[model samples]
Target: MSFQWTFLATFLYCELIVVIILLLPFISPRIWQKFFNSRLAKAFAAGAKYYFNFIICVFGLLFLDSIRELRKYANIDSKDLSAPHAEAHARMKQFRSQRNFYIAGFALFLWFVIKRLINLLVACAREMSAAAEAHKQAEGATRHLEGVMAKDPTKIDPREIIASPNNPPRYVEAKEHEFEIKKYKQEISKAKEDIDTLRKEYEQSMKKYNELQDEHQKSQIQLAKLSDNESSKDK
Candidate 1:
């Protein structure tokens, strides 16, 4: 009976050690990786650590008590449970704990790295938007300046011509072209506004011309009637 109990206790202790060793790799990976990849995994892992630690302590205490009971009831050899082996196990546990501590530090480092990367992306987007806006504004200003130069090509800056000798003329025969464009635009606007006035004047002139023509026709008829009356009276 004592041998069976000792064997069972040894088996349980071995199982616990196997579980702890297997779990160390999972528990010590960067926290952010788990947080981003799977929240459920991260939670499970955290919970597992606590439960595993509790089980280890419980088993250690149980094994110590079991050894004491074996010594009293069965007279097992004391040489088998050496202090050096226990001390070595204690040191191994301490190493595993330190390794886990480093994992926490790695998690923090990864978090900062990801955060800075996001910030850089946002900043780049902002800079691109600003550059695009500035480019649009510059294009508009260039167009406006070109129009001004077209209107007075003869007054070009000699300094610009000298500095940019290789650059081709942007506005050849510009003064005439600019004047014609300006004149056409003005005529178009004036014609639209003067349409009503022109219509009114045309109607008035037509009325005057019709009245004169009618008066001339009536005088011709009156003269013909007078000539006819004189001929009849003479007869």
Candidate 2:
């Protein structure tokens, strides 16, 4: 029981501070945003996370040691209770009560661990949500551009706006966009030409194969007749 008390006191007084540090990112995202972006802060967070894990491991070891101490103390206590001396028996009872109090301290450690896990999960969810939003925006922009490109290309000339001083910003931007659309259109045309060339080559190859197969079949039939005549002559 004394061992349990020692464990509780250690965790409450010392380990609790480290747990708060671990939870700071989740407790206040503003703090995370301010500090997490800096190189020093990132490095510190990495080091702190590592140190926190190390501290948890140490706590585990101490808990194990406490368990052993508790068992040993319990054995001594059982013997003391049986002793005729009331002084030692009262002392042992007090020690047992103290150790029992330490048993609840492990739950505190468990609470901290759970909080840390939730913080990590929250950070991951935030990043995934941001990424999803960015992808949605990009897809929307792409669809809008495709719609514009589907219209008549002759109407979207950048050169007409270039010589005019009163041209709007949109005209200049549209001109740049027109150049991109034209380049993409040319690429599409080239791709179509390549596809046609490949199709023609494939047809030509199939025709040649059929012609060769027909010639081979005719030669095989002629050979068979010559062999039959030679066999009859030999007989």
Candidate 3:
């Protein structure tokens, strides 16, 4: 094989190995997330698009060339086939062309597959991370609600204190004296509303977390199926 063709074959092998590694069940999404978020990975990702495009272009040209060679050999004149040496040479060229076609085609195809797999894994990782954060927030809200409930304002009434037998009744200034009592009631009502709102928020966060977990599971199942198929093909 020519150096270029050999290099393409080597690259195709590497791509296959990478796909298998990525699909391995042992590697968790969190590890993939950490790797993708690393500075080196980020730097590589910044230019990966352009590099992938260039590779696609190169492989595309090679694939086309292989097709052209295949067709050329297929259409060889009967006059050329009359000579055994010419016939053998044409057959050899056709075989090489076919081999190159498969190599280039698989390389290009695997590139796209690998890219998609990485995206799927990354999305799963991010969803799992978000779900965890939401769970934490929900727990915090629950704790806050517990603390607020523990300090129930209804246990201590300003009106009850003012109306106590030990205190002198101010009947003449009753209207003015009730002002503080009304303000406290309003404050207590507002606090209850705030607590309700917080409870609702916590519920919503938990719901979101559940949805993310479902999506993550689906992604994992899909990845497992894909890996299984690939492994079967290898076998």
Best by TM-score: 3
lDDT of each residue in 1-235, candidate 1, tens digit only: 3453444445445555544443454543333343434878556767765775665565455455544543443432456447658655555545544433333333333434444543454565567768889997777666656755786544444323433578765545557599888899999999988998899999999999999999999999999999999999999
Question: Candidate 1 — what's its lDDT?
Answer: 0.57
TM-score of each: 0.29, 0.39, 0.58
Ordering by lDDT: 3, 2, 1
Q: How many residue pairs clash in all the candidates, one count each?
A: 0, 3, 0
Task: Please report, in order, the local distance difference test score of every candidate based on alpha carbons.
Answer: 0.57, 0.66, 0.86
Worst 10 residues of 3 by lDDT: 153-162
RMSD for each of the candidates? 20.8, 14.3, 34.4
Instruction: List the candidate 3 regions with Cα displacement exceeding 4 Å.
Output: 139-235
lDDT of candidate 3 over 117-148, digit per residue (tens): 99999999999999999997777666656555
Best by lDDT: 3
Which has the better lDDT: candidate 1, or candidate 3? 3
Candidate 2: Cα lDDT at 28: 55
For the record, the alpha-carbon RMSD of candidate 2 to the native fold, in angstroms, is: 14.3
